[model samples]
Target: MSRLRTPASPAYLRVVRASAWYDLAVTAGFATPWTYALVHDALSSCGNALGLGALPELDLWQILFANLMGSVVVVWAVLRIVGPLPEHGLFDGIARALFATWQAYALAHGVSQLLWLFFGVEVTFGVLQLVPWRRGGNACRARMRNADHRSTGRSLT
Candidate 1:
């Protein structure tokens, strides 16, 4: 896909959907305390072995917040996968920026280095969705023109 393609383009829509899939795959396990405990254990063991500092014992507040975030992200990911609208890309990009910033803050505070993996993916998707891909190219122009025609009680061939 061309980096400069409009958000309305198929390429851009696919990018948005892909990000949603990534989110679903990574966060779905965090939606419940049981699953989150398992995930937490796995991460802690790996981090410790790699000298990356294991997560502290899961606290009640931590589990609550994790569950909330996981539930919200799962629903959001489902929406994007079902209907990847151009506007969704914009909003998701903004959300990614916020996530990346928070991830950075956590890293600074000595969180496990494993978080850097997620942080990198967030930054990449954030840039991909945030780039001002608007209003150019034959494909986008033709699609928009068709929509405009339909809105005006006409049809384009």
Candidate 2:
């Protein structure tokens, strides 16, 4: 006698998709505010330490460039998630570079010693998240391919 197995239903898939989106949203919500606070506090402290006043009066061009850079980062992040490229593509590298730069800037500007602890944790997490793609990333690609095939009603074999 053969045992019958039931495939996941549409409702189940819906729940899974919803959960994934919810998780991503929550992560972003937390990350954005944390990042903003970290950068703002760091920059503010740096300016203060340098005797540059309460807030550094960046030129309009500088502010524009910073905004443009941030926009590029957001686009890169979205593409990294949606593109066929590995999750740890250029975006991860960019994130690592940004984190390193920020750390160096903070140190150079004499940011609060306490802030370094939070910076370290942020950098650590950023670096670790990129590891899955850096080491044996093909495994992840293969899994993604399998999922795609399954979703498209194609046989993995």
> What TM-scores do the predictions have?
0.83, 0.41
How many clashes would you count in candidate 1? 0
lDDT of 2 at 41: 58
Off by over 4 Å in 2: 1-54, 83-91, 111-118, 133-135, 138-157
- Model 2 agreement with the true structure over 23-94: per-residue lDDT tens digits: 243234323444444555566777568665444444556455545555555554455445324433324544
Best by TM-score: 1
Worst-scoring 10-residue span by lDDT in model 2:
1-10
TM-score, prediction 1: 0.83
How far residue 74's Cα lies from its native spot in candidate 2, in Å, is: 1.7
